[model samples]
Target chain A: MKLLEDRIRRDGRILGTEVLKVDSFLNHQIDPELMAAIGKEFARLFADKKIDKILTVESSGIAPAVFTGLSLHVPVVFARKNKSLTLPDDVWTADVYSFTKEITNHIMIDHRFLVAGESILLIDDFLANGQAIEGLLSITQQAEAEVVGVGIVIEKTFQKGRQLLDGLGVEVESLARITSFDEGKVSFLS
Target chain B: MKLLEDRIRRDGRILGTEVLKVDSFLNHQIDPELMAAIGKEFARLFADKKIDKILTVESSGIAPAVFTGLSLHVPVVFARKNKSLTLPDDVWTADVYSFTKEITNHIMIDHRFLVAGESILLIDDFLANGQAIEGLLSITQQAEAEVVGVGIVIEKTFQKGRQLLDGLGVEVESLARITSFDEGKVSFLS
Candidate 1:
């Protein structure tokens, strides 16, 4: 977590007050070494929960999900942003609003992947509005699966995401939690 | 490569001549151990080539790309499927037609991540019509970057993806090359 926070300070760009652009190393362009370390840290944090699967949304979440899955020796199921033809007829879906794109898209997971009674850990790159994680949670709930915990690489504490998850009574862990971005400088919630 | 071929034979479901769904381990629900093995295989196959970075598309490609990047000890830059607010103004974009979605989507890469004269190894989950790689090639070409080679997890040999890459004079190594999948029985090219 220290390493991740340090990396965020060094490379993360504060886009106004709401967004932290980690495109240099986190999401758009990935640092696999750092990612593996993050994964290890997540695994270390959630090692007690006994996770059967790591669930995430597509695109950005795949990197850390893969890494965490590697460390935990579990399978990672990423919910698709679009309903591709390859996806089977039976799927667990939830509507997720994209604040960036200013649209709502249905995130889906094949029903075969998320079976009943499986324990799932949700992972993602950034948790700001918490819509993405909420969507993932919807799918997990629909599958009649158990929600172990939520693992996040970077979290915006100023936003309602953590509060929202707290209301759901879900255990949440974020490697880097950003408290504020005042004057384009990132401040963390120590 | 042999291991991957064997995995496809064992777990892969043939939907038709074109679609081989390995979502159980490859794409949707990822087996990190198997993916790490794949990453090792790709590293072994492209050991001779000096690759500075591994480039891939988001969603499915991120898992193997991250694994491959870890094994190779390099950065993995994935092209964004949608234009996100986090990405900067300057970007290299390309239009790619998805046979599954039956629509064309623009994939973009942050210009800063890719520099001129950097040798990149393109990695992907599947090589079907080769449009994804072609779109990546366009981005690489625009950046003035040199593509060392292409590493594909599964290549549909019946399709023109390999031939297209061959025509481009690019070295391509497919872990599993499917010659035919007629009647749902996969036949691989030796």
Candidate 2:
């Protein structure tokens, strides 16, 4: 976790006061070694829980989720944003609104992949307003799977995402939590 | 490679004559163990090459790319389908046409991640018509990166993908190569 925080501070760019661009290492251009470390950290954090599978949204979350799945020795299932021709018809889906994209999209998972009673750990790259996490939680609930915990690479604590997950009584683990961004200077939640 | 062929035969579904869905283990619901096997296989195939980084497109390719990066002890860089707020302006991009989606979308990678003369291995889930591979090749050319080879989980040999790559003199290693899919039967090139 300290490594991730340090990396974020060194490589992360603050866009104005709200957006944090970690494309240099986290999202677009991934640091696989760092991802492996974060994955180990998540595994350590959720060591008590029996995680049967790891679930995440497509595009950004796949790398860390795959790494986490590797550390946990579990399969990683990514929810697809678009309904592709290859996707199965029988799916568990949820409508998620992307604040950045400003559009609502359906994230779906094949019903066969998520079995009932399986313990799942949801992983994501960023947690801003919690819409993506909510969507993943909805899919997990629909599958009757138990969510052991949610692992996040970076979280904006000033946002309502943490409170929303807390309201749902979900155990959320974040490697880096941003407390505030003032005049382009970022502060972390101690 | 045999492991991958076995997986495809067991879990892969042949939809009509055009689509084969392996969402059970490859793309949608990923098997990390199997992915590790595939990654090891890729590493073995490209072991002689000096791979600086693993390059892939977003969504499906991320899983194997991550595993491959882990096996090779290198970073993985994925080209995003759409430009997001987090994406930097200094990027190498290309437009790709998805025959499945019947739409043309732009894929971009930050210039910071891909440097000139770096050896990159392009990883993808499927190699069908080679349009995606061509786009990636174009992006690599733009960045002046040397594409060591292309690694594909499955290749539809009946399609023009292989021929296109051959025309470009790019070496392609496909774990499972499908010769044809006709009359609900899938044939592999042995």
How much does each candidate deviate from the true structure in C-alpha RMSD?
2.4, 2.6
- Give the clashing residue pairs of candidate 1, or none: none
Model 1 bad stretches (over 4 Å): A83-89, B83-89
Candidate 2 lDDT, A105-153, residue by residue in tens:
7899888889899999999999999999999999999999999899999
Tens digit of lDDT per residue, candidate 1, span B89-113? Answer: 6988888899976877789988899
lDDT of 2: 0.88
Worst 10 residues of 1 chain A by lDDT: A80-89
Question: What fraction of the correct interface contacts does each predicted structure contain?
Answer: 0.98, 0.92
iRMS of candidate 1, Å: 0.7
Worst 10 residues of 2 chain B by lDDT: B82-91
Q: Score the docking of each candidate (DockQ).
A: 0.88, 0.77
